[model samples]
Target: MNTIKDQDLSKNQLLVKNIVEHAIDQANFTIKNLSKRPTVAMLMECENCLTDFMPVVKFIADDHIEYAPIYDQMCAAIDAVQMGEDLVEIEFA
Candidate 1:
């Protein structure tokens, strides 16, 4: 995937980036990882952490078909992770 270097992000991309970073921080995680946070499970370490960020995910997913399904799958995985003893490998349809 292509990466936008410093000072090259569009307003929308920057907004999304800031939201993701805020979610990650609110989950008590460090930001030393890569930018390709394709999976919410990859960004969050635990179910509670994912739960903490669900509101932001819902906000982003609302009315955004491109991201809604992805968010839905991650939300399912989060519920599964919380209820079961296994990590669900849920993916976008």
Candidate 2:
């Protein structure tokens, strides 16, 4: 028989998996729609896309300390996109 701790862990794992997959799909959709826009606009939209899902990632990290790396990755990815936007602005604007 599965213990209570085991059951809780399984549920958390499923929740994390769903959240990550959904975030990936959401980002992908946003990126696909942005492809025709200007480079700067694309980067800005991408930043906004990541920003929108960041809270969900944070929520996961808050409840599941073991998934902190995923949260860190999300932060790094957002920072990189913001940097790209800054570079594009510097180069063209």
Candidate 3:
């Protein structure tokens, strides 16, 4: 992916980034308070929200450059949540 900074984002890209950030933040929040590993069904709402933002990320900028980190954060959060890890503590790639 190409490199794109936060300051470089367009209006549309910023909007997409906001939604994706919300998805990841909420997902992390849900898992952070839990004491046990989450089942996929347990994370269904967060997962669904994240999934819904997938297509939006791809359109955020040329080659989806500006939103790559958001996409990565979503993937990492989902993986860690599904794996019973601390979503808030995990540093997404």
By TM-score, the best candidate is 2
- After superposing candidate 2, which stretches have Cα over 4 Å from the reference? 1-12, 28-38, 85-93
Q: How many clashes show up per model? A: 0, 0, 0
Candidate with the larger TM-score of 1 and 3: 3
Model 3 vs. true fold: TM: 0.50
Tens-digit lDDT track of model 1 for 25-85 = 5443422221234245554555656676777767877845555765675577566555543
- lDDT (0-100) at residue 70 of candidate 1? 51
TM-score, per-candidate, Cα-based: 0.49, 0.61, 0.50
Order of quality (TM-score): 2, 3, 1
RMSD of each: 10.1, 7.5, 7.5
lDDT of 2 by residue, 1-89 (tens): 66786579778698777877677666656555555464767777877877988788788779878656666766776776766532111
lDDT values for all models: 0.55, 0.65, 0.58
* Error at 48, model 1, angstroms: 1.5
Cα lDDT for residue 12, candidate 1? 69
Off by over 4 Å in 1: 1-9, 17-45, 89-93
